[model samples]
Target: MDPASSIVTPASVPDPRATETVADLADQLRQLRLAAHRPAPTDNPLTLRQLAVLTGLPHSTLGNAESGRVLPRVEVVYRIAQACGVPDDQLPWWTAARNRVAGRRRRAPHPAPPPPPRERRAEPVPDQPILADDLLLELGGTAVDKAAELLAGRAPESVVAFLQRLHPALVAKLLATMDPVLATGHLSGLSPQHAVACLDATDPGTAARLLTLTPVTAAVAHLTAMNPEAAARALAVMPGTALAARLPHLDVDLVRRTARTMPVEQRTALLTGAPLPPAVTGELLFSLGFDGSLALLRAAGARVAARLLTALPADPAAGLLAELPARDAAAMLKQMPAEQAAARLLGMTDRQAAERLAPLSPRPLGDVLAHLPVPCAARVLAWFADARRRAVLQRMRPERAMPIRWHTETATYRLWLPTLATEAATSGATSAPTLAELATAGPPPPALTPGTGGPAATG
Candidate 1:
């Protein structure tokens, strides 16, 4: 079959009708691809064999997909995305487009279902009519009307209060029912504290995810409004590095402070990610060498300093790098992308620089690994002497055990030894969580398991 004449035949006896359904599904995909303005990759993202191997659908499936014959299952749709080397979310948009198509397959427009009667949630106000106009605009009124809402009102402020207090899903519905652009814009710009209050009432998980879309200021405002415990829990679920990565894009200072008290990965993410004035970056590095600076950063009580090292510049970054005494900086730096770590390599003293640069050895490998994640620096070196940890405790500023334990507990000894250990063995350390093991979802490292290492066993 000439590839140009796109058509498909399933392996079984050709049922023109079934092929037509598959063909229809394929056309839906094609239309969606066009609508999304997708361009074909320079190299075909799918090979005939690979696509068949992954989807278990035939090459004919592609043709059917291009045509209008077959509808892929949800997994098949994901497989199609995988085959094309695109994210899975791209498929759902097509599914939505197809759903719209399905809706259009009406039997006979059975007199458009009568619009549901409006519920009287609040009494109508005189003069200041509370219509959708308050939310939307006068523009062409048509587009705004079509966008988010048709609201405008002089209803008692209590009505706006009620809407504000509604659950997020209900808010989604109310907003959806109103003019889109107007409602969304208004919701987005609402007071941060109020947003946080509303968000707190929502599942923390959902709120954490949404926090990315909302302005950073808004996130801070909402978090400020939330009780500390609730704010902390929401922050706990979000890794620091992940949050920090977005900080550079934010035009807010609060992002830095907010991330200061988060766990390692999350903090690392924020530090490495937030774009900074070189002066700020340098100052941040200077602080990494100072005890009180880090303490103050984490005083907000969410993310702490240890996890945020990845976010710093080379001088400050290296300052923090040298602080990981008990750990192997080389080992952790080995885990990092060399490009990020290499920048720090340029400034330090010979011995200090050697410890950090040792990871870049093995020539070609170092060059290859240089582009890896930045957090691997401190993490790789956690196997060193307790003296080093003490140095960190001191260099970071004679801080007590609680904050140190709060920040750098990734090492096995970090968990059980100094902080959590009994004073009779008083290495003068922090107290550890009493859980027999680390609270992890998967199995812990064998070295950290019972009796694996002496200190680990003791802890």
Candidate 2:
């Protein structure tokens, strides 16, 4: 009889009953590998040594995996499967095989209970482990800055609790000395409401800057938990991009609630403040991530959203619009005054604008056009390249397209154009003639001389 006859191959089905013991499970894995393996024609059948070389795992590790004393780890099973050239589709079977081994080990019966213990005299408990604050206190006379730097590296919750127990002046000093990034990490770990309270306690400008340094998510969370008025004040002084980047993280409902909390004066200021410098605008937009910026823009009423979109460089502006959901994007377009919306569309190259606008549904597109001043809407439509223009027109109902047709032929300029030209034309013209121009062209009766004219006027 062959010695190998008793050995099970990969072809053998796993016997669920046979896997009751850890040792038995390890044997099954070894047998499965031996059965499933195929070696090159010139080579001897696959061996553990070949598998070790192929897998880059130490031969000793493989040896331990096949050892019956303990179960192999998941990585070990994966490595073994790779060594055997298992197909991708069949990898799950190996995972299942490993899980079976793990489950069997878990189900092993617990050892019998030890005999009941006899009563004994109680012993005093060891002194409790030192608190973090106690440890800091032990650093007597250590610079507050140094102590803070050390503590900043520890878990935030622990540091916060320890810091809260210290004098406020000392806490302020410590925070001033700590790295902003490190402080940001620590602050983020606090509950949102608590973080807001802590921030509120700090100097407002410092608090706003510190919040900017925090992860956008954590910063937004604290802001969301804070009063809208307080949040608005903080945002007003922080980097514009910091707030802009965080805008999307606020949900639509949350935005409405926060917006409602602001006094009308604050709301107007927030909506119409001086634009951030171009560099700051770009940075803020980039930080928001495309999805975030788009979401916030969608929620923002049209005029404010258009102002923000217009501030971005053309590429970013086009990219953002391209990614927006058709309905939301169209709604925003519709909300803007016709000229402002048309101007924004004109800012992008015709091809770029058409491609982005193409996906919007007819009704929203028609609604936006219908509300637009006919001439402004016509100009916007004409700006598109012929092919795109034709395609867009096809999407609109004939009635919707009529306004554009009637207005397209009418030439119009911005309302300020004539005022600007008039200013330019009369800029060189003065209320009184210049001495040189008036000398030859003025009233003929004054020809006598400067001396005679002055004497007569004085008399």
Top candidate (lDDT) = 2
Q: What is the alpha-carbon RMSD of candidate 1 to the true structure?
A: 20.5
> Which residue ranges in model 1 land beyond 4 Å of their true spot?
1-25, 31-42, 45-99, 102-200, 211-236, 239-245, 251-253, 268-459
Candidate 1 C-alpha lDDT tens digits along 73-126: 434443454344333223334333333233233212456554457843553442
TM-score: model 2 vs. ground truth: 0.32
Query: Each candidate: RMSD to true structure?
Result: 20.5, 22.3
Number of the top-ranking candidate, with TM-score as the measure: 1
Question: What global local distance difference test value does model 2 have?
Answer: 0.54
Across 1-459, the per-residue lDDT of candidate 2 in tens digits comes to: 122222334455343233544577577657655654343436455567766776678888888777887676656765565456554334345544554555444444677765556744464442222365676676568887678756633434456666656554465466666655445545654555566666656665666776786657667777777656666566656664575566556654444444444344443444445565445444444545567677667776666677777676645664566467645555556555544444455444333343445555555554445544444444445534566555555666655564455444343423322343453455423342222222232112212234432112323
Cand. 1 Cα-lDDT: 0.41
Clashes of 1: 78
